[model samples]
Target: MSGLTGAQAADLTPIRTPAAPQASFVDWSGGYLGIEGSAGASFGAFNFHETRVGARAVPDFKTGDATGRSDRSRSATTAVGGLFGGYNWQTGPWVYGVEADLYGANLKRPVASTAQGLGYEGVDPAFSVIRAKTDVYGTLRGRFGYAFERALVYASFGLAGANARILATEPDLATGAVSAARRDLSYLGFTLGAGVQFAVTEHIALGLDYRYVDLGTSSRFDLGTLPGPAGGPLSTQAGFTSHQMMARLSWHPGGLTLPPEVDETAPHDPDNGDTGRFSLHGQTTFIAQGVPGFRAPYTGPASLIGNQVQSTTTATAFLGLKLFEGTELYYNPEFSQGFGLSRTLGVAGFVNGEAQKAGAPYPKLRSNRYFVRQTFGLGGETEDVPDGPNQVATRRDIERITVIAGKFALGDYFDGNVYAHDPRVDFMNWGIWSSGAYDFPANLPGFTQGVLVEYNRAAFAVRAAYTQVPKEPSNDVLDPRVFRRAGTTVEFEERHVLPFLDQPGKLRIGFFSNVGNTANYRDVVGLTQAGVFDDINDAAAATRAARRKTGFYLNLEQAVTADLGVFARFSNNDGRTESLSFTDIDRSISGGVSLKGSAWDRPADTVGLGTSMNELSPSHRAFFANGGIGLLIGDGRLNYAPERALEAYYALSLSKTLTLSFNYQLVVNPAYNKDRGPANFLGTRIHADF
Candidate 1:
């Protein structure tokens, strides 16, 4: 469009190569996504025609004289910033691609005009003002470029659209009265730009572009003038044109590669494998949830009430180091704050897994995990492990022994269900994320000091762990006497490839036992019967002793299709003893399906729907019926029913490293009590990882 012929512009200019080529040039052919910041000025012309107005006149008002038309126009400048993504197809030296971007803008201007003695036979005086603003804009463009080694110069042209606000106000100078109208309009137009990019690395490029955009005029005549005899219908038209100078940074995931300058012959570091010697990653999650209204009989120590908003936030940094052959150390430092609904109480399956029971006004930082993992390959088939948080990309034997020790969550080692593991990116309910009744072992923040041993074969694996639990029920401090007061778990997992579905699936069964100072539900009942303050909670204090609680759970995850998977979990814990940690449920069953949005052209997006039913054992129910409270669930009195929960969520990938999700939950018979009603929770979450 700029006058150069297709032959001259799209074809790369021939240039002589170096006498002796050292390395191949950077490849610019690939899909790229990036964030960019831009500062620019938008020029806009707004024209307002005072065709007819119903307002009081100054000296006098004549209908015909007031109907006369008047026009005023003005223009101004603004700033903008946003995100863009594109893919390029390279044939030889020519690159062609399409890009899309959205930006926020602030381009506003005001125009005023005064007419003295002009309306009624040069006797009426009036003043008119118009304000115009452009709030948002986006573009879709096709770009063509020719590469010269590590640099590319390109031109782009695109369709553009914008949202604008127009306000027109007129005041009769003689009457001190005002008439005003406002209109919001969507305008469509075109844009053209040119830029040159220089590759800073094989995968990263920086560039600057100068773009010109023109948003065609939007006219509205339906905004009737303010109430008055001299005010009628008014017409307003606004147009915008802008020149932007934007600095852009682009990251090509497929283009990340090693530089060409490395030596041909160098000793390889054994510990690094293919992922290098050290890795660092971080993630931040923020969730806000609330219930609009729910039925409740009476509020107890732990009861969900109607109309409440609760939010939680967590940020974590993962650091990994390769220590020696088959050995690695990983540590995670985290900061968290805020509380779940009802201070993380009420429901057996409490919402907001990111929330801790003890929340502080300010962020609380803790060493969440520090562990050493050693793997011994037994000479067999291998599996590839991709680089991720706390993990180094590498290959390991399918038949191997893995030893892990230090501080970590027991969930990290056992009863892992693929459909609902990560609260930051998947399901947020506690019961669904892990086996609710298993109560594997953890301090207040859901971590423990432990050692784990795993033996893996081609299609089967066995794992066991011994960890320290809290010193007392629901306490945050771990018991120092790990051998005396500890938690142990064993699990077996079998992997299968289904014949008809041609998909992979896993079935895991686990058993867990925790020895700690805990109270017995029956003993609490007995104490209450013996006039121990007439409260079951008081009976719990009188019955505290060193006890063992045992539980078992079955977990299954089956991939039904390439983009669809289903998971189910069934767990039961001894109901005689009070819950030492985790939720109040003694028996639970949960299942769900997860689907990838590849069918809709959004492969990174995910949707999940799940339901869970939790029940309390007879003694546990009796305690609650006698006004007793466990860790999370309680009601003044109980008309017992299974705590049933249905959860659904849709997670949208904003970028490779950012995701946004909307979650909904429906809970019937919260806290296993029919008196307290069905509650609905709505939540929004944002997660970013790097």
Candidate 2:
């Protein structure tokens, strides 16, 4: 047997480097005994025929031809981990060795329907939310390899085992989600692979490899996102082999092996700074109507024959400047549209879910933003105005730089959300405000702590915002909704805590209030705002006009126990006579019990998670609770923007910068009410702050 040279001997030893935050603890060996670790992200989403925001204002029906293939994927996440050493015995000029990969991932796949049935195929508009989970907890790969001098050939026959927990794989047609509880399955996958590797130098090397891995099948988990065959027994015919043939390069200097004498000659600059950086990322989508998979009303309006191709898409760009240490000045711009499949003439397919129309494709959109990470912001925004029938209005926005200080801020800030709301001209919505405010720290002697005094003069200068509401589509197919609405808002609000009243784990006094003007609906062409499901008529628009309303909200809570609490809410409104008041204007009060708190008594060490684990917000973040309840009271903001719901929820922490929570919301005066009262159900979300 030939022994390795001095340099090769050093390379053969395990690197023992720390694993990358996003990589697995898998090692690669070279020349029969070389160990390796690589961290990179992967994109496994299958976007067969999806134009989320269409290309040229196209709608679903008018989108391209359907292939019935939905896309279920996860972007490759960068993983960090290292491998151990393994001996390679060479016989007949061939070498063999064994290797293992020890690593974990927080993988999830959110699968949704991309193609709803055409023209109301109506059999429960195929839908699903494949709460995808891909966790190959860890794998020990056994390998036998071959080596010919400097080059090596290898084969791996290993158990690609994983601890998996699948969610609504088989969804319910009625709900377009899962029916039963999660179907958890432990899978044993056999992965077969072969590759060629070469050592470029004593510290750098490269290789190429391929794999065919299979995790046996189980129940049908159709990620009904694509228009084609969702996952099932039929979809099973397609094997679980994701083929990849790539070239990779590696470098292992082993912590500056240069000797002390040579190090003295190296120059040094102990400064880490970037001149400035700019980045841009965006995706565009397009859809057209009157195509194969869409439906149009046959009798109603001949022009409404439903053969329109509406396309909607948006592209975003960002510019940033590192003004100093730990701070940046940023500017971002976006241009978006909502339809290309169906023409702006109100193609009914996307209007009523009965035939698969939820929210109308936005006729037009354009916006610009500029903000400083720890300072001031100056920017402008604009959008196409909505007109009656099939036309949209053109609106523009402008902002001047203000409040560029750190210690105290006495300037004003205006946040805006505007759109056509519908294909209605006069039925427009606009909100404007110029307000001043003062902020105080939570740790202060004066009663001013945690108190933000803000007073703004805002209202529809022209339309006088009675209330800007969102219009919901009468029906929803397989897509989530995108609302394009125009509304005017003028208001004043305040939030603060009571002095020294910080009774630990006890009653806490807080106050919040809001006041705004009422909206006028007579001019609204569709007689509905964007994202609303109001079904009246042009004639009813008059009566609904009698329904435009606005008001203020107040909430207070007190801790009763370590996990229990109590709270109350108040809605104050102003309408000429109770008769003209909208349903949300009613006044009622209710009280209920609440329970929520941190689950972990203290924090734990996560240094072993990955190399980049320290890239998060902080070393330790106290997990807090956001849960409360109040008896059925006056109707909440159930219109365009659903009210900040009052529900029973327990938010759990996942890490310093992430939280994994499961909440069960109790509907009070629910927004989109079903024949049955509000739904009491459990929902989950993972919150992460980058």
Find the candidate with the highest TM-score and give its number.
Answer: 1
TM-score of each: 0.63, 0.29
Supply the global lDDT for candidate 1.
0.76
Overlapping backbone residue pairs in candidate 2 total 113
User: In candidate 2, which residue ranges exceed 4 Å CA deviation?
Assistant: 1-328, 331-500, 503-535, 540-550, 555-646, 668-675
- Cα lDDT tens digits, model 2, 1-690, are 988899999988997988654311113234233333222211122222322312111122323335433344523221223333334444444556665554343446544332243332543433433344554433445666654323345787677655555443445344455443354556566767665554444454444433444555443332223232332221211112222222334454431111111122222222333122333322221211122222221221112222222222233344455455324454545433332222222210112111111122221222334444332223345222222111111121222221222111111121111111111100010000100000101011001101122222121211012111223111111111112221223333232333454322212112112121212222231334332424323322333222323334333444444444444433333322111201212232323453334334523211000000000001000000000000111111112112222323334443332333343333321222121132232333222221
Root-mean-square deviation (CA) per prediction: 17.3, 21.4
Q: What TM-score should be assigned to candidate 2?
A: 0.29
Give the runs in model 1 whose Cα sits over 4 Å from its true position.
1-275
Error of 2 at 220 (Å): 28
Output the lDDT of residue 35, model 2: 38
Lowest lDDT sum, 10 consecutive residues, model 2, at 607-616
